[model samples]
Target: MPERPEDDDQQLGSLRPTRYATLAAWAAVGLVGGWFLHPVSELVNATAPVVSWAQPLALFLVAAILGVTAHATWRSVHVRRERLEPHRAVNRLVLARACALAGALVGAGYLGYALSWLGSRSELADERVVRSAVAALGGLATVVTALLLERACRVRNGPDQA
Candidate 1:
């Protein structure tokens, strides 16, 4: 049977891009805050005792925390939007996406650094590393944006069945 306009509207209404936008905005703010606080690419240079793992790990942790903050805000609004207390089902989705975004960011940063480090000295290496880093950053951001958009869809439409 064909879907009705009401059904389509329901589906559309179920989506809440506002929530995702809010989350992204908050995360971006957190990132800006981190930048101001650090005043340098802390992710690139290892500042702690464990440089080997600390750099990437720190970046991941920071990004994750920011994601968490964003998710929390999303959850709050979701709860209010649905006129119900935060649902575990929905909250879990938000958390999962946030974690995924954080992981992607960390991975991309590390790969960028590795590519650059491996290709050091020569102009070709420098160019290659820079290209890789930019690509990684763009990919991560796209993933994050997609995830957030998906979450927004879920918020409005309820979870999709597998």
Candidate 2:
């Protein structure tokens, strides 16, 4: 049997791009989570010696790796003659989507925590603010890279296919 146009349309629509609203919702959840966790973090800081630099650095590294991988994947898929494996492409899309959501949440949470520390007169307030800000930046980087990766996964249709 011949394939219907509607069937092809449905298949194309299944590859829809990620929505901003979904990201926003995740960020909102992060904001609320951060607000709640701020006090707990402060309490833990008071009780134990915590390294402030590690979190941001780790996030930054993850972001950099994701960005590089995304770029390579895009180049391989669009510019190079080699075709991407179906399983590999699906895996990349899944990873990108997961990272995008996670990055949004983490970034919002760190930003919220940093805002909470702003203008505080406590001895560790400056350090906390700075670290949180850096972490937030790292998170932002992850979000941006993840979004780019997601976009890179799009399979452009040729004139004949379209």
Model 1 lDDT tens row, 1-162: 876776676665343333445545544544444333322444556331112433444544545554565565466546545433446545645655655555454445434344434534643445444444554454355446445534533444354421
The per-prediction CA RMSD against the true structure, in angstroms, equals: 11.5, 3.2
User: What's model 2's lDDT at 117?
Assistant: 70
lDDT of 2 at 36: 62
User: What would the per-residue lDDT of candidate 2 be over residues 1-162, giving only the tens digit for each residue?
Assistant: 876786587577456667899999998988777666667865877432232899899889989988998999888876773577878877888888888899899988888777777787877778877888898899889989988888877776653321
lDDT scores of the candidates, listed in order: 0.46, 0.79
TM agreement with the true structure for every prediction = 0.33, 0.84
